[model samples]
Target: MNDSDRNPIEDTRFGEITVRQDGQNGLEVEGEGIPRVTLERDPESEVDRQIAIGTRDPDRLTMRIDGLEVGLKPAKGGLTRRSYRVDVEYRGADYRLVPDSVPGSRLTRDGVHIGDFSCDGDEIVLAEWKEGADIRPEDASIGYALASAFGTGGQPMWMLLIDAVGLATP
Candidate 1:
């Protein structure tokens, strides 16, 4: 098969934001008035992922902005295959992308609710943004990446109980 025929294009959009996955490498996020962003899995680190702002890849957890090294630290989740959330430290701020009741996730900064991430069919949507939220493109990109990599909602309580029961039996 040809390269184009091998990779199926999946494009999703809500408002000005758009996310496209080519069924191969990773997804690219684009929106109005913001730079395009791309996220790809890290082959070296099983638990780590990489993001490229525009077309640059500096490192797994670091992205250069305006000639300054912007550190992106993985506090928890998203870095692992089984994680249900992503707690990140970026630009001296703590941002959390957590699963929500909407079968999606909520984004918060320093414990303050900022926005929600949801999916419409194959399209990932930035559902809601609270008041006074700057809602940077980078943050939205990361949030979507977290949801795509890990998942939106976590496992049910019954699943956990079943795992516990299995452990007790053995």
Candidate 2:
């Protein structure tokens, strides 16, 4: 869908942000203080999955955001759990995009909850955000990456059902 066709996300810090699919494996996000962000999933990642942000080196699985080279990795939650983790690399900086069992994910810095996002239909809504927290373009970019890569829309109904069952089990 075109940017005009997609619903814009109203964020507290960035204002109205638009997200759209660039192609089969890429997503584009636009907003204030946020450069037009693009994330592309590597196709030959049957074993080692990776995402390339903007013009980052695909082989390195790392991207430069605001002068910091960040590494993105998807770790399996477990054999049964469908959740995954995205880790950003920096000295003493612990950034993670932790998925909620439902539709979206929580952005945590050093294990502190700072932002919450949810998927409603085709739109991603920022449910909650901590005031005065250091908001950066990379933060929103990571959220879009997670939603595009691991959101419920990409899963089959049967897999979703299994995930629901798994959540209910423990």
Candidate 1 TM-score over all chains jointly: 0.57
lDDT scores of the candidates, listed in order: 0.50, 0.56
Count clashing residue pairs per candidate.
0, 0
Candidate 1 has which clashing residue pairs, if any?
none
Model 1 agreement with the true structure over 84-162: per-residue lDDT tens digits: 4556555677777766663667788788887876653233444566768767655665565545444455445566678
lDDT of 2 at 44: 45
User: What is the Cα-based TM-score of model 2?
Assistant: 0.62
Which regions of candidate 1 fall more than 4 Å away from where they truly are?
Answer: 1-14, 22-24, 44-83, 120-123, 131-134, 156-159, 162-170
Per-residue lDDT for 45-108 in model 2, tens only? 3322332222223453433444355566655443322345556654466777666545566777
> Model 1 scores what on Cα lDDT?
0.50
